[model samples]
Target: MRPFSLRVFVPSGDPTGVLIATRDDGIGKATIFSRSLLGEVKGRKEWNLPGIYLLVGPSKLYIGEGDPVGKRLEDHAAKKAFWERALYFTAETRLNKAHIQHLESKLVKLAQEAGVVPLDNGNTPQAPALGEEEYAFVENVLADLLLMLPLLGYPQFEASEVAAASSDEEVDAPHAAATGKRRAAYSAMPRGLLFHSTSKDARATIETVDGGVLLKAGSIVASEPAPSFDVWMPKYAQMRRQLIESGVIDAQDGRLVVKQDQFFSSASGAATVVRGVSSNADGWIGADGQNLGDLLRQWKQKNFC
Candidate 1:
């Protein structure tokens, strides 16, 4: 992946409030805000521009396009109780209604295909006809939007399992020896270094995201939480129960199989959920047999230093 610089502006001066993110030489900017801060960001001039928006919740997502985005956002705020945060991408007045519609269609379709987050959108509209240069403009804008998702701690749109399976290192190389039982590591974006964690009967794959680690779907996790886990990490234990009950991890068959990619606030949290025990993610191994924590430290030193 090519290196790019991102600049994030906190308009309200609160780190958790409205954030405006953009990349140098990029086509568009992403404005993010929580539902409570809607009124504060609503009056901004950019909200009146043509754009595509994402409404995010704990386990669901909604994608839409707005000629002037704020009207749709206000409608959602009044009716959609699921979304807690919202983000919109726009390139000032460069995008038209058809462009935003096409972008929204692509996002909704991909999110549904990922099968990670259940989407509130039921149907996808067809992308409008565009000339060669127009098509390029929309696709370029789409790429920029995707790259910005990780900045807000959203990685649901990028499927790690799919990327790992299709990656050149894991599939194209015939003689490369895999280090772990599942020595498959692939990065679909920046900060997405992969790891594979295992127990006697269960094996799972995961990768680091911006704010957390994401456990991939189809991973075999322990069906029961360990007794010590309940005593030590009670919040994670509760999260496990919630995931099981919400059908995120299917447990009805006596075996725990994840149906969709799952995100946890921390690597250890993801490790504990997958292994059903008290665990540290630092020990998890990548495809190269390097410790997850060590690889990350190296990455930080290389990037941040």
Candidate 2:
């Protein structure tokens, strides 16, 4: 990606209430404020303008728009307890109600389709009609927002790693099959390594990806976490419970089978969740049957040099 300039300001020396602005002329600005800072955020001049905003917490998300944004945020702060932080988007020139409404509807649809975060929005808002220029402007704003949100520690707007991987597979499959050379090039490329659990009873394969590790679809997880599971791997244990509750894993033939492709942020995370024990990065192996550490070193040497 090409380099772009971003200016960030902390009004009260608190990192939680940050103002982010891009140097790009048409891209606009975003204010990231913690829910605790609602009173301070409300005092900002931006709140009086028409804008779209995102309310995000650890696991839940809500998207909204307001003609005068401060009132909406004030209402949410009073009634909504799940959100810890909010991100508000506004233009250089104040947006009209119709423009903000259209942007809100599109962002809500995007969040719902991504399915990475649980949406707290009870109902989907209808998008207002827009002229060609207005629609194009909103689209550009959306693209910029997606890039900026991740930088501000919110990745819920981005597509899930599994979805991105699946898209890559679809695009590469036919070309690799037709050219044969494509397959050779891929085999030679320093891509994410794959591995299998060393546990005798666990029939699972895992692969590391750009942002996370994948517990491939159809892999097996323990029906219940190990007795020492929480003591050794508290996060994975919690994730396992969440997976079960989310219906991503189901008991089938006396074992837990993954219902779909699942992504974890690290190899050890995926391994612990699948094997129910603490795992080391060295435990995994790559396509050439080398240990993960060695494979990674080799990849870095070849690519970075």
Candidate 3:
């Protein structure tokens, strides 16, 4: 068996929900799940996580004004109701007025900065009636948790080794077919990567194949290819142009345009859009040392020029 390791980093002091795992020998890869930034999990810590959070920020606040924003807003309200009790039970009761009030102040600051009007003073802040301020603060806390996850681990999380599956079956399947004794090597596959354009004009699509990796438009940027996963690169002018024209992608949002692939919808069956830098360590093409724009320019010179 290949050497395997499983380690996770949850920032020392931050409360963001982040899951970082590294697998196999040192050669194995590392993956990070930004619970807050990815919006994959509601709370970064089982207890200290906030209830309602707003995605509004200078970043491409994946949640927008029209249908997208409206839908997410509705879900946030429903989540407050459905998970209210459970979330409270899991909260870090250790939080005192000082802590809670500090968070509250931060929420107010963020809201005002973002131009969000505060809810009426009469509204309750917790479950059954969580105030807008409380909700927005939770989101801020979530983002903080995500930022801290990478710092949590000493070296990073690790993953266990997984054996590669064998294709040969029954020994003589192919030979049997030739001799009329058995069937031929049959490997049904799923097609994937149908629509990989960063351009919003290009509708993200995926054809079923034996092995499928759906890369859709507006998908979140990540090192690995998976559901709600994507990489944002405004450097791709073609992609940026399409997204800007499509009215779905926003350039000033500090996020690259990436649509979702229907094949890999959220557990809620909704399309997910995350904003962040690549967390795949070495998996990212030009992450640490090189600038993406420089690389793109080189690519254009070689291929287009």
Candidate 3 per-residue lDDT, tens place, 7-37, comes to: 5545433444444333322211222333233
- Considering only N, C-alpha and C atoms within 3 Å, which residue pairs clash in candidate 2? none
The top-ranked prediction according to lDDT is 1
Off by over 4 Å in 3: 1-93, 96-118, 121-189, 193-212, 216-253, 257-270, 273-305
**Candidate 1 C-alpha lDDT tens digits along 51-80:** 899999998899998989989999999999
Tell me each candidate's TM-score: 0.54, 0.52, 0.19
Total colliding residue pairs, candidate 1: 0
The digit string of per-residue lDDT tens for model 2 on 191-246 reads 45667765645667776664446788888886645443443344566678779878
Clashes of 3: 36
Quote the lDDT for 279 in model 2. Answer: 58
lDDT of 1 at 284: 73
Q: Poorest 10 consecutive residues of model 1 by lDDT?
A: 163-172
Please give the ranking of all candidate structures by lDDT, highest first, separated by commas: 1, 2, 3
